[model samples]
Target: MPEYKQFPLADTAEGLTEAEILGWRIKPGDEVTVNQIVVEIETAKAAVELPIPWAGVVTELLVEPGQTVEVGAPILTVDVDPGGAAAPAPVTNGSAPADPQAAEEEMKPLVGYGSKTVVAKRRPRKTATATPEPVSEPVPEPEPMASVHTVSAPRGGYVPLAKPPVRKLAKELGVDLYDLTGTAEGGVITREDVRRAAEPASAAPAAPVAAGARERRVPVKGVRKATAQAMVASAFTAPHVTEFLTVDVTPMMELRQRLKTSPAFAGVKLTPLAFAAKAVCLAARRTPDVNAVWDDSGATAEIVYKDYVHLGIAAATPRGLVVPKIRDADAMSLVDLARALEDLTSTARDGKTTPEAMLGGTFTITNVGVFGVDTGTPIINPGESAILAVGAIRDMPWVVDGELAVRKVMQLSLSFDHRVIDGQQGSQFLADVGALLADPAVAITF
Candidate 1:
């Protein structure tokens, strides 16, 4: 018989204890190559694609998609035959195959590799044309209209059905497969279809939720569980002092608009978040002291002037607040930064951010503007000495060229560990970010 091997989930990153299975790429009996993306998983930090480590034929899937599994758990089973196909079908109680068609159907690839039935449908037949009626003028033929069909199971039925997780996603977005256009192979519904349905139309109000909804209880695990423990410990152990700075951000907004039309930023989303991030990075360069670490055990201050920018973007997810760091933000162009931000935000919103994505953030930027709030004194994420909060941009009266004029303005709040950064140093960092926003041309100087 063919020897079966189990591939357990590996540690995606440090501090990640668990992950939710998003979906599988291959089915049972399909040959999978090394480094082929066979599975997609969501960790606390972000949704990441996982590649198969060894080349082999898939034998079994151990974990169902959408199931929350701990790190090191068995995820799938594979038949590793380095030489060639060696094993024969096992004789169950020495019984022989009675129905060949049933066996052939069983051998077909299912989503979980024999876990469920593939959806199938029937086909239509040709029809004869009616005899032409005796008339003086010939009847005009009707023009063929384009037919838009919803995605569904194949004519033979859906093979390799999506796991429970994908179904759950479909339900949350209020998507009826009967109404959506599927993009999966052979018209099978995919998770992407559900996501597309969730997007709200611009200028249209969002659908209202059911009144008096019951609270959902999700057991804390993975990156979310780790962040919670660290936050509780930090909040009580460290002294946090948050300061605010309201500035006119009209110039930064104007710069973002112009960049979107530029050849370099073509096809990239140039938003206020990009400007806020750039301001934070530039401000960090000016005041290195704000990026220091407070070592309580050593009873000394460690001011770190990081050579590279590991800027963390704070995301509020359904799981919890997770801060995933974008490594080497300083090396990224404005367009690249915007793309990264979009990807990171998408991963976070989907509850797939992994643990490795959460670690090693030198500084963090949280946008409270998405919530429509003016400003907030945000809590500092653990291990990081400082965090900057970007508030909603609003039009208000302000002094422009010594005259009171209406202009776009926003409030920025900075929170720091008092033990490491003094008030003067904190103020300087905040001032620098504000200055950069007031005149984005200063970014070129840096």
Candidate 2:
């Protein structure tokens, strides 16, 4: 008679379809209070902790950790009204419990146990004339199971001792767990065992379009999977046009060196990327087309231009490439931009960037310069029109006023969606950004 409540996996971000259960805070039979942290999940954007909406006793965890569940699917269940009525009888073939003792005896053991040998007991020979049919003819053994999900030999098709996600991973990698013994405690097969079994096959020549090979086959599931899908879709959907510019930035470099000792910029990790970020914001004012989106879903093709800039800084982490935005970046002072960039990047590297922080980016800047690369033709993010790739700032010989001199120089590459921004607008925007980086003092005129 207990009222059961199922907790579904909710969409943590816009267009997020699924998430992998990272861990559980409570188990079956554990008491839980409302607003208690129940589970941690990793979505496409970031990892998030979910809380219980109602107080209850954890009745069951429908899904195990490492299993990816779709949005709106129930991951756990609870008995919300456990004290209001009698405990529900054990469900066995739709029949009710025969007695209170039987119900009490069967109520426990909610957790799974490993399969044991099912031995058949024989009865003593009776005083009958018929010779009791000898306990012979032998008990027929089970056949060899073709799949890894089933245990082989004496256990027949009985379930083996492996976690659900481990089993899932084994099957995907084509590893036969029945033949390979697990190295885990109690001989429970793990993901490492499965991958080890698949090692020989992984070394074989990969197919033309295979996603993995060369000694290891990793299943793309989390951030890597999401990034690949997004980039592919953006490349195919948007017409990308990349432009480049090289500028002598001696003045800007001198200013940066001077600002390091300034009282206003004290305690701030002012970086060259921050200067590029500020430049992008100021340049967008003259070329709003670079900040617009192509809205083809409407009745007719329309361009939606934004008044403010949600500047995105592309950060590479252990997970994947994530672009977290600083909202209203154009309104911030140079010092404020420096502080925001520092915090945003550190949070991203720590894998703590929230999904909301990655959304609604109007423009993106990727510092390839950090890797000592010159420049790259970056692909535009789907929702935004432009992306700027900052190249390595190096000392090179330059001609200043028809006189040769050694100065600091940097390269900038801008990729934009041609459908929204014309060639002229894109060129002007790129030039303006280069001008700002070459001369930080030019920002006062804007």
Best by lDDT: 2
Question: Candidate 2's residue-wise lDDT over 1-446, tens digit each?
Answer: 66555566766776777898866777778899977988878899887788877788887777667679876666776777787886653444434244555333233211121122111111111124455566757844533322222333344444566664676677677777676787889788888888888776655886575544434456788788888898998999999999999998899889899999999999999899889989999999999998999888978988899999999999999778999999999999999999999999999998889888999999999999999999999989878999999999999999999999999999999999989988999999999999998888898887
lDDT of 1 by residue, 235-259 (tens): 8866889999999989888878888
| Number of the top TM-score candidate | 2
TM-score of 2: 0.73
lDDT of each: 0.70, 0.79
Count of steric clashes across candidates, in order? 17, 0
TM-score of each predicted structure versus truth: 0.64, 0.73
lDDT of 2 at 201: 68
